[model samples]
Target: MQTMLTTLILGATIAAAAPLTARSLVSDAAGQTYDYIVVGCGVSGLVVSSRLSENEDVTVLCLEAGALDHYEDDILVPYYIGLQPDGFYEWGIYTVPQTQLDGESRHIPMGKGVGGGSLINGMVWNRGNQESFNAWNDVGNSGWGWNALLPYFEKSETYTPKNYSGAEVQPELQNPSVHGTSGPVQVSYPNYYWPQTNNWFEALHELGIPTSAEPNEGLSAGGYFLPLDIDPINQTRSDARRSYYDPIIARTNFNVQDNSQVTRVLFDTSDNLTATGVEFATGASAPRQTVYARREVILAAGAIHSPQLLELSGIGQSSILEPLGITVLQNLPGVGNNLQDHGMIHLNYNYTSPVLADVNDFAINATFNDESAAEYYGSKTGPWTAKPSCAVAFPSLEQVTESASSMLAAASSAAYNLPSTYDDEPTLQAGYERQMASVLSELANENIPAFENLNNNAGGLDLALMRPLSRGTTHITSTDPFTTPSVDPRWLVHSFDYDVMILAMQVNQRILNTDAIKYLGPSYEYIPQDATAEELGQILLSGIGTEYHYSCTTAMLPLDLGGVVNEVLMVYGTNNLRVVDTGIFPMVPGSHLQAVAYGVAEKAADIIKAAQ
Candidate 1:
């Protein structure tokens, strides 16, 4: 019966296909000069452009490498997250082979279209721990701590209470005061949750991890139902395009160039470091053109591409550009030096008894059968409205391991002797020292969650190292902007990181052994149940992957500490050039990047407005 309903509604909906409005092309742009020219229409680009274009006198032009969204069912539906990667909307980039992970290279999935990663990422909306932001302020970046950034976080989202037909919404699960009600992005919980989630939460409770009243209130060191960027009214994905750009695209002063790739920032002269405009190409084999930025040229191309653009524009480390025969415009060594990402390991388990429902059945792998589709199309409810995983737990070292103090001591010792490359330059040395101190502090404090556990409904658990000490680099190997940069995340190079991951895995085993979880009947385990920590370490090293939260490539710090941008997000040497993306993060926060990206762009808009 369910299958029949879903199929009929899907067929009817497909037959009534609506025409998508074509966005303004670059050729249609009337003027050559604009008050602000924003590159990359991702989360940051859209927010910055939307807010800047509010002033009717100022013109804001946004250039996106990918075309406008088709609003395809796969992209709009909340459950079809994992399917969007490597599709037409993806950038199709991959990381270089990671030597620590046994020479394995993982795909670096980034959204290519106007919405950027917000269009394709798993819609988990996490604000991360408060201490993570405080660490930024501690490192010379004032006005960036938790208290300073809370307003921006609240300003970006319009929080809606969870309401579904069959499932009872838990009032204690959410705190309304910390969320916004009039923001652009819509955030809410699903109406329906898998029955197995109850058992999972029970297991967490049995293990002494309390349920947080409001994790977004800056303290997320407990179990919680993760909020998603989905609209409760329409039951669709609330991406950057839908929230920020689509509403303002019709403004006369706001213009967008789709399917356009920016090659480099055009400088006034080879000797001078002034950014006048940018050179770009539209579509494949199109003629290159230059457009002037009357006031500023903002790079919101994201962490990977932002740094890549800087290098191609001759503003990166001299050693990298000089070797490529590109003239050194500004020798900023920090452009791509501090690349960091959340390394994750998935642990799969098999159930002995038939489970109530798996995410594959209704979420990511739903066949769109008649019943489910009918329910969704008719009432905007059911499993189609939810993502694969909704429940997440943030566990600190003390909660997961018995030797938290010993581990902290080891990390403190390791901090003093970081890789020699960190000390090769005074700037790099200072940055490393600050970052190491922060890492050690988090490791010692039981209040801070060192790792995250995502309860994937398919009986698989995703364990991620939230605050990793391992740092890597992303640099251009050639002068051509078309060539992909060499990205080495250097996963698990530090011994302390390996220790923490092994301990996290042990915590997973403990959760599995709980009566509430064990009743589900564990028939299989990815790693043997009796495996020792050493064996688990080996298994983790071979299978570790990224949480896709790439950040901190071009950090905001004091210039003496290898900072590429100031607190205002302007590039260190260039006056009219600024970056608005995760690349400006001083370090990777413990949460997903999308939430922070939106907040950063919101704050950036105010900064630019104040300057004007």
Candidate 2:
């Protein structure tokens, strides 16, 4: 019973795998002078390079530390989304022992290859709530509100509606005006869904949470079926390299170097402090080489590396640099401060018996996995074409907690404070004051989501902290560029963060008892049932992870507000140097950051183009 949609998608395998012309070796790119040099060829760098190269006279160069992307099934097939691709696609970064998590270090998964996180992330395509983006504007960044950023969000993705589906698996679309019809990134609905998806949505509805038909319309406060970045036609990942680079990479003006790590940005010896070029090396032992940037050097090296690079180049806090015996070029204390991430706690269940109509068999029986693989290879319409969880929702504090009014009241007042480090720095404290106001306001408003929940249809859920009050820092412990940076996310340090997490866990427990989803015969696998708040808090400390939504390390705000970059994304006291990555975010928005990353990069390209 193959449908016509499957036939069309099967015909479109490897649609754009043509050879690219970007320089593959550092030797080829070294000593080369380009109009613009973009560091770290991830999501933001690729888009900036491609958009700038549109002008035939302007030359753009992209430098990536990892090797070029390999389109293997492990990297692209949606079925394998649960297992992270380590060593090749990710940086393999981990945090220092968290004091609040009982001295246990956590892995910080970041992208390494060309497409960056777009290649390794679960392809959940959704946008931030309107209130969150509006907070960005309210905090002094002009032209960055939801209204201003919507065009870029629409301009980045070309939506393709689901052509064929069973009624249960189909999703509702937002208005055509909110989506782009001819953008580069291919965004579409998966051809399949989980077994108990209907029951899951029904359960949320029964609890008074609505189903969001258009989660991308600046309003995503309820349950919605998330889309994937997979190209429906090719039945494979449509990552940044494929969507933004490969098609135009063969252009003579656009050149890229893989397997090259930028050690530092080279600035002129003059008082203006203009960036002249960058020093890069293929490996730690290899000879470092210089590549000149005639106009500008853009740092799109993501949240972790961007701050590391800035500090390595002597543009960070004087206190942090002077201790490491490095001269400070700028005294910006906010270079590696204001770090934020969405901490998640997972609750899984084991079924009492086998259900033939579900995907649970694929996890236990090896033979079932083989059968599913065979079917996926034969015709692209099997369980392998979908992520482990596509049903996601954003719930307000009122939806997840019984004490929303009291919690919001405490958060809004001076009842609690961030970690002590935030108070020591006056600039950081002022900036956090604004962020605290925005997040607390969102927590009180029912239209804004306070947390995110992902349902795997196996009676399991991942509750993520959307508006965390805890703040942390990421800094370089050594002067050696090859050494790993010190990353401290400070998870659950603030009392309210744990309070909300414990409440969210209780809500997940309640969801399992709902009449709509109770028929699954669910039994707890990891989370405790009928446990007191103290017991739940201890378990959360033992096994908490994040959604990998890292941002705000090199935040964008006013100079006096502990900001590393300004409204134009230009670093303070520097000329011709900009950061156009998620690192520039003032706070982690209340959604998966992939869609917003695309929108931010698109808008940044326009801003950079206009500046010239």
Provide the clashing-pair count of each candidate structure: 11, 0
Question: Candidate 2, which segments miss by more than 4 Å at Cα?
Answer: 1-26, 163-170, 413-423
**Clashing pairs for predicted structure model 2, backbone only:** none
- Displacement of the residue 182 alpha carbon in candidate 1, Å: 0.5
Per-residue lDDT for 1-612 in model 2, tens only? 224443343333443443455544334889899999999998999988999999998999999998886565556677767665357588888898987787888988888888898888888888878889888888889989999999999899998867334434355555678888888999986666656787788888878877776777867587877777878765677788788887886688888889899999999959667999999999999999999998999999999999999999999977789899987988888988888999987777655546534556566765656656666666666676765567877888776667898987766654444555455678988888888888888778877888788887776687899899888888999988899999888877777788888888877877877887777777876655687888888889987877888899889889778899999999999989999999999988989998899999999999899988
Report the lDDT tens digits of candidate 1 across residue range 1-612. 235545455534422223335455446543388889999999999999999999999999999888887778777777566755446598788888877777889877888888988888889898888899999999998999989998999999999876333322253457787889899999887656777777777888889877675678877586777788988777778899888977775788888888888989988765456788888887447777888888899999988999999999989888779988999888888888888889998788755556555664553334543445666777777766666567778888877667989998887677343333355578877887788788788667777888888887556877999898888888899776777888888878877888888888888888889998788776455678777988888889888988888888899999898899999989988877999899999889888889999998999999998888
lDDT of each: 0.81, 0.81
TM-score of 2: 0.94
- Model 2 error, position 261 (Å): 0.4
User: lDDT score, residue 611, model 1?
Assistant: 83
